[model samples]
Target: MKTALPKLEPGYHQRYIIPMMRIGKNGNKLKVFKIRTMYPFSEYLQEYVVGMNGYNTKGKPNNDFRLTPLGRFIRKYWIDELPQVYNLLRGELALVGVRPLSEARFKELPIDIRERRIHYKPGCIPPYVALLMPDSKGNIEAERIYLSEKEKYPHWTDIKYFFKAIFNVLSGKILSS
Candidate 1:
C-alpha cells in the first residue's frame, strides 16, 4: 500500500510561514516565521542539500534547487523575513540577538557557543547583519562577539547592533539568505 502524504494546511503553499520549529533560549521550541522560500519538504533535506550544493559565502546552500524564483527575489530584498516580526511580538524572538537555529544546526555548534546562545532570546536580525561575514567561522565569531558584549552591556549592545544592522540592510551591504 502506498503511504499518504500529509496534507499541507490551506494557504500554506501560497502564504508565508515557517517550515519548522527552531530552538530558542532556555531550550524552548518555537515556530519561527518566514516566507516559504523552498520547495515542499525542503526542510527534511537540509543536510543532504547543503552537502551536495556546498555553502555560499553567507553560509547558505549555494545554487540550491529548493528555492523558487520568487523566493530568491524575496530573500534578496529581505522580504522573506518580514513574518519574523510576528515571532518578535509573540516573545519568541527579539529585535537583536543571535539568530535562532534549528535543532540539528544548534547541535552542530560547539558546546560553549551553544551555552552562550541559550542564555538569550533569538533575534530577527542576526549579528552577521552588522559584520557581513564571509563564512560560517566568521559568522560564529561575530555572534561570539555580540553575545559577549551583550553580557557586559545588555541594553546598549542590542541597541547599537540594531541600528548597525538597519544601516547595513538599507545600504545593501546585507541581504537575507
Candidate 2:
C-alpha cells in the first residue's frame, strides 16, 4: 500500500459512492464515505462490504476468488476505510459514533435502532469496536454490546469517544481492524 493518502479529485460523486440515507418519515441526508466494496447494485445505487468470513453475516465471502487484486490489498490493511475520515472532516460524521449503514440496510433496521443510530452524526470509527476488533463476529458483537449503551452514548459526547478510541488504538484492537 502507498504511504500517501489518495485524495479524491474534487467533485468525486460521493452521493453515488458512500450512500445518502433517507429515514423516510423526514427528509435528511447523512454523509458517509466508503470505498467501493461490492459492485454497485442498480436497485440501490450502493455496494456491500463483504465480511471477511461467514462469522455472523449473510454476504458472500470476502475472500471470494473473484475479488480484484486491488480489492484484496484494500481489504488487507483497511485502507478502504480511510476515506471516511473525509466524511468526518466534513461534519457528516463524528470521530466516534455508531457506524453508518446503507439505505438498503438502514431501511431494514428496526425503527428504534435506526432512529438512534441516526440521531448522532455517524462516526468514522466507533467505541465498542475495541473489544470487537477481530472479525465480523466481533463487529456484530460490538454492535450488540453497544445496543445496551446506545441510549447513553449520545450524552457520552465526543471527548469520551476520543479517549476510548485512543485506548483501543493503542492496544491494537478494532471492531474490524
Rate residue 30 of model 1 by lDDT.
Answer: 80
Q: Estimate TM-scores for all models.
A: 0.89, 0.58
Q: Write the per-residue lDDT of candidate 2 for residues 1-177, one digit (tens) a residue.
A: 645534545655434345434332122566455565444332232233333333233122444544446655675566677877777777667676666665655665456666556556666666555444445444445655555565665455555656777776667664232
Whole-model alpha-carbon lDDT for candidate 2: 0.53
Per-model CA lDDT versus the true structure: 0.84, 0.53
Per residue, candidate 1 scores C-alpha lDDT tens digits across 82-109 of 8888888988899998988898788877
The prediction achieving the highest lDDT against the true structure is: 1
- CA deviation > 4 Å runs, candidate 1: 1-15
Looking at model 2, the pairs that clash are 133-174, 133-175
Model 1 residue 77 distance off true place after TM-score fit, in angstroms: 0.5
